[model samples]
Target: MTAAEDVTVVPANEASWDDVAAVFGTTDYPGRCQCQRFKVAGWIWRDSTQEQRTAMLRAQTACGEPGAATSGLVAYVGGEPAGWVAVEPRIAYPKLRGTRVPWTGRSEDKDDDGVWAVTCFAVRKGFRGRGLTYPLARATIGFARERGARALEAYPMITQPGKEITWGELHVGARQVFADAGFEEVGHPTPRRVLMRIELSIVD
Candidate 1:
């Protein structure tokens, strides 16, 4: 287990919107994105205001609503919301369907509901670089398996020394992050982006 595995991670529906907002802060990429990059389609996302995006995220997360279905997972450290990961059925992300990232070299069914994707991750501003994403990524394995996902996939940045990628571009994660979480690199869609996957059915 990674050092940050001790952090407690929970379903977004069980967390409060305030805590979720805290993780996204009020500035930086995560703040503006609200993790909706892959959720909404092109024109809808481009035309929607920040407030509309925020509302869409809140509804997707269903935060603070007990028994509601949530779209992601939230992490807490010392009882403070510290990180988040968007792991849901592949079909849930409308934008992902039309993107070249996942379709560049494979014949994957864009509508496969059994395949889940770890599309985004955000660590609280003050809580970043603390390995919070390690646990967040690991948690996705079980989160997806329990939800009946046959496999979990992520398109992550392959970090190289002296080569810097903006955090906004690395939201999916780094190559090692998913590797540590037991994902194997299956393809390199681009120089920085690599396709990683864990087969839940075989792992059992």
Candidate 2:
């Protein structure tokens, strides 16, 4: 296990595809989800082989390929990929269409490409509760903003006392992570989930 102090968060494009796979392949929580939940739609993902999913993730995130910029972010805990966060223009995720979390109580255009969304998170088993998500979320803001995202949104869950949610359930992320990154709650589409947003101005 890598020490927390040695952890570094880098763009997914900078790391090898294998490093990102290490995080997803560490366990078979659901057999190669590969953080492809939002990237693919419905049963099509179900039929895709692990290798297929892996290749899609690699292409989508552009891992280890400097020239390609359309991908997510990966967190390396002392040279080992320990976590991942999916941050991309809202339009990139077809599965989000008509989803209650992104639409309820909001009157925004569904096809806006300038609006980025933080769709999911993956923290490797041993790196689960070592304060990884927050940093990943923070780094995501910079990643999107630099790419000219006018606003970024995330659907994160609210945590409460006496309520213990498993990592699988909290894969979207925790509300506090967004709050700390200066995102304001735009709406609570679900009782446990909040749609948060942060506006960015290129002129600033």
Candidate maximizing TM-score: 1
Summing lDDT over every window of 10 consecutive residues in candidate 1, give the lowest-scoring window. Answer: 40-49
The collision pairs in model 2 are 61-71
**lDDT of candidate 2 over 39-93, digit per residue (tens):** 6755556666677777788788787677787668889887777888889999888
Task: Return the top candidate by lDDT.
Answer: 1
Q: Which ten residues in a row have the lowest lDDT in candidate 2?
A: 23-32
Tens digit of lDDT per residue, candidate 1, span 1-204? 225545899999999999999999878989888888877656655566789889999999999897887889999998889999999999999888777888888999999999999999998888887888898999999989998999999999988899878878789899999999999999987877899999999875
Estimated TM-score per prediction? 0.94, 0.90
- Give lDDT for model 2: 0.82
Instruction: Tell me which residue pairs clash in candidate 1.
Output: none
Alpha-carbon shift of residue 192 in model 2 (angstroms)? 1.1
Where in model 2 is the C-alpha error above 4 Å? Answer: 1-5, 43-47, 202-204
TM-score for candidate 2, please give it. 0.90
**lDDT of every model, 2 decimals:** 0.89, 0.82
